[model samples]
Target: MSRVAIIGGGVIGGGWAARFLLNGWDVAVFDPAPDAARKIASVLDNASRSLPGIYDRALPAKGKLTFHDTIAAAVEGADWVQESVSERLDLKHAVYAEIVPALREGGFIASSTSGFKAVDLGAKGASVVVVHPFNPVYLLPLVELSGPADLRLRAEPVVRALGMYPLQMEVEIDAFIANRFQEAVWREALWMVRDGIATTGQIDAAIHMGFGLRWAQMGLFETYRIAGGEAGMASYLEQFGPSLSWPWSRLTDVPDLDDALVATIAAQSDKQAAGRSVPELERLRDDNLVAILRGLRQQGSGAGEVILAHEATLPEGGEIDGLPVTASRCVPVTWTDYNGHMNEAAYLELGSWATDGLMRIVGAGPDYIAAGKSFFTVDSRIRYLDEVQCGERLSVTTQVIAAEGKKMRLFHRIMTGDGLVATIETLLLHTDLTTRRSCPPEPEVAAALTRLARAHDGRIAEGCGGAVGERP
Candidate 1:
């Protein structure tokens, strides 16, 4: 098992530990603070509940977590070392000095420093790269990386394996890319609050209710391109470029962090948040992010596309009784209806996924579809015997009912952690994509299907081969 050493137990450090631990990497954490362990545990609890919710598939079994008294102990035998100590240069350097001797030779080192450039971190002759991540690191997939190309290349696969997108910088600069843009907005917001132009809540509302939505999907340039209408980017620039000279923004001025300004911002923020605690707000943020990401998953755009691509690479489900556990997942909040139970359409969707799982089992997946031979469902019957609520775990088991020539029949049982929830029976016909007509599956697929069919011949579900009807 790979091991990572985390040198800090603050929010960012704890987030890093959670990300690594959840991804099946044994983690060693070293923090001198008194409540470091409890703090890390809190972060882990949030991460455990939120990170896996974003994916339809299960993450790897969690790795072992160990807390150490010193940086040397944490870095010992570790494959990777991540420093998230205080941003003070002396503190960071001191931590590095103690860790370098214990760090495994050839192992990678990363710093979660948002304010410092990679070059600055390496000035002490330590080979640390900036692997700066956003808050709730386990949920947000963007990690800004800056360092020597060799080190960046080594870190790319590791970061990507954690379901994060590593954006390698060509030139090192203070604050990096995302934060530079963020700083500009933050400075302007501070000025607005100082000048009494807008409250914190109103400023936040402006983003959350408007361009934030656009930025999440299309980003700035594409959003502007769309705003260009028929003419495109050049026309957009022609129309809006003059606004650059307008005094609409206060980018150059700095807001004094005085008592009154601080109090106003704090009071406004408190009012905006109402009575919700930090943990409550974190959960709210995570849920909204999950919904947005899932929506983008449908379009296969932006961060949603990243998740989709990552999902494609996840390990396939294991088997039960020789048949694959086709679909195992937590029913997302969006899948439930007003009654608080999973909707009718969701049953069919799960059943469809089970059918797709069967297709994969029989060697008829993406390549088969690309090769113009695929299964098309012609008939389906679903029996919802019990209700499943949001956040409940669900698993689907498939039984091959029959497989002969171009025709295949399958039955799926959808079970919750408590008991069986639903069953679906489907009849599918192999088809030639070009001709749009029934066609015999290739020999490999046919043989695999036949094998499964024979294995499940006498194991049919009770609700299989049933018609939709009311009890008399």
Candidate 2:
């Protein structure tokens, strides 16, 4: 229960606040604009919808939130302070001066500075660390930390406690990790357009349809390593190292921002974005990130690891409150078959989604699966009660049916928006993470199963465990 103070309430600051608050840290915020409250409200609205949708278990009760009229009041009891005021050095310096005296000695202060160096900012303080977090702070796991060597050890765990994976830079570098990598691409893209090598859309297409897919999963070095075959990283570097000297673009040089080039890029970007507003694009981006990351969580790879790490922190089965609800999506066209209905495989997919939700409730999830244990389907009895056609919306409700020793049974129903039952079923399981055998659940896990079982003890469907047709 550390108290976190978010010093500004713009998009980035509000995202930081959402991440900390949802993770169970009390948060206080200070923002001077009269519309600050409204702005943060909008940001949190999106966050509330987006954050909890990524997982099935409930988010920890959001830590209490308070708004402070002054900087001192906000930082008064804060154990960690995140300064996300405007990037101008003068503003940052003023904020540091205002809050420094109130910050407890050894209490951490991090500047979400995308470019400014902590040492160069010259803000005199007891301790300071540069914690450069990207936009959409709540979802992105990467945070690059740089400061004096001694301060890093103190900062790393604080970052981890906030549920971020911190990459400590041995030598402080400009813009840290992801941003620097982004800047390199940006510089090259600009050069390409300026030199008439490619249209704006073409460059984006090349990346998004090409290297971007590979980079998303494996990243630059590892991707190249895979390409190296049996030779490994050293061999890959040796073969490609010569190309580095013959580069078509200069990493160190800044591209000229000529009016003609700027207009061409801007017009192309406008076309690329269509008519979507900034907020619309932001929402779209978040939705895609959530869907992609959630899928990865199931596979136990990629950015899904962040979701998996979070799953480990959840309590086992119990009454959970304040979990945010996400928007529902229609079954994708790809899921439909020649018969114009969701294919048989997609039925199992929906059932798997239901299982993911149930597992989260019972404290078995990605991390647990990663640890070499998980609930695997031992038996299933599904009935297609009614027809569900392509493009139709679907929702499912899950209930624990029975629990005894290592085995438990779960029942679920898939329904249309109008409450027509399209499908119904029971799934029986003996979870086995290792050897993939039918093994009994661990005591803690069994206890969770038993509690869920008792909650719905008498409410079982017909043909399910002899508890006929009675549904809760």
Candidate 3:
């Protein structure tokens, strides 16, 4: 197994640890802070509950996590060393000086520095690449990679394996790409607050309620391209390029970091946040991200597309009792209803996923669908036995009850840790895409289904063929 050494246990460092550890990479963390272990553990708790909620399939089992007192102990035998110490050049340099000697031979080193350029980081006489990751690193897939082309290329697979996107920079620049754009907005916000033009809450609303949604999917240029209407980007530039010379933006000046200004900003931020604690705020943020990403996943656009691609590469579920464990996932916050349990629609969705899994077992998957042949549910009856709340783990065990020429029936038990939560019985018909009508399955699919049906014929569970009120 690959090993990653984390040189700090602050927020970013803890997030890095969680990302690597959750992805089944053994992690060694070295931080001098007395509460470092507790801090990292807290981050792990949030990550464990949040990261896996984004995917339909289960993540790899967590790897071993060890905390060490010294950097040398942490870096020894590590495959990758990530330094996330304080951003101060002196502190980073000191950490690097200690880390270089302990780094395993040929192992790569990365610095989670947001401001410093790669050249500045290399001044300490070590080859450390700038791999700046966003906050809540376990969830956000984008990581800015700035370094030599060779090192960046070599590191691409490792980053991708962690379920992250590596955006390599052609030239090493301070603050990198995303942060440069962010800094401009941040500076402007500060100026607005200082000048009493807008409160923190209002500024936040301006973004979250408007362009933020557009930016989440199409990004700036593409979003504007759409705004161009029929004429395209040239029209957009022609219409709006003159605004660049306007004195509308205050990015040219930096807000004074004085006590009064700081206190004002702090008070405004407190008012904006109301009574929610940091953890509460974090959970809220994560939930919103999850909902947004899932919506994107459905459309297969932007970051959602990234998630879909990564999910496709993940290992399929293991089998259970000669049949596949079709569905296994945690109920995300969005799946809950006003009744405080898994919603009715979600139950049907899970059943559909189980049916899709069975189809895959019979060689009728994406390729089959692409070839204009698939299954369409003709009827379904769901029996909800127990309530499941958000964040609860759930699995579905499927049984093939019948499989004939063009028709098949399936039964699925939705299970929680304690016992069964619900059951779904569904009837499906093999379909022809062009005609939109029932059709016989392809030879290979029919044979596979026949084998499964034959094996499961006598092994039907007690609830098989039962209506809502009728139990055998």
Best by lDDT: 3
lDDT of 1 by residue, 1-472 (tens): 8999999989999999999998899999999899999999988977876676667776677899999987888999999999998889888887778888887877657999998987777778788889999998878889999988899999889898888889999898898999999999999999999999999999999999999999998878999998998999999999999999999988998888999999999999999999999989987887788788788878888887778777777666787666679987767766778897889998998888888888988899999999898999999998888888665667888989899899999889888767888888899999999999998899999999999999898874787765586321
State TM-scores per candidate: 0.90, 0.75, 0.95
Off by over 4 Å in 2: 319-472
lDDT of predicted model 2:
0.74
List runs of model 3 lying over 4 Å from the truth.
417-419, 470-472
Cα lDDT tens digits, model 2, 1-472, are 7799999988889889888887788989999988888887777766665666565455666788889999999999898899999989888888888888888866757888888887865556535688888778877767888887777777788777655778888887778778878999999888888888998889989997899878766788899998777999898888888888896676788788988888989998899899999899887777666666667777877767766786666543322122211113345444567886667777767777777777766777677778777777766766655566644556666667777766666766666657645334555566565576777776777888788777666663544543434443
The C-alpha local distance difference test score for the whole of candidate 1 amounts to 0.86
Q: What lDDT is obtained when candidate 3 is compared to the true structure? A: 0.88
Answer with 1 or 2, whichever has the higher TM-score.
Answer: 1
- lDDT by residue for model 3 over 141-216, one digit each (tens)? 8999998888888788888888888998999889999999999999999999999999999999999999998999
> Which portions of model 1 show Cα errors greater than 4 Å?
337-344, 370-373, 378-394, 404-407, 415-422, 429-444, 460-462, 465-472
Strongest candidate by TM-score: 3
Q: What TM-score does model 2 achieve against the real structure?
A: 0.75
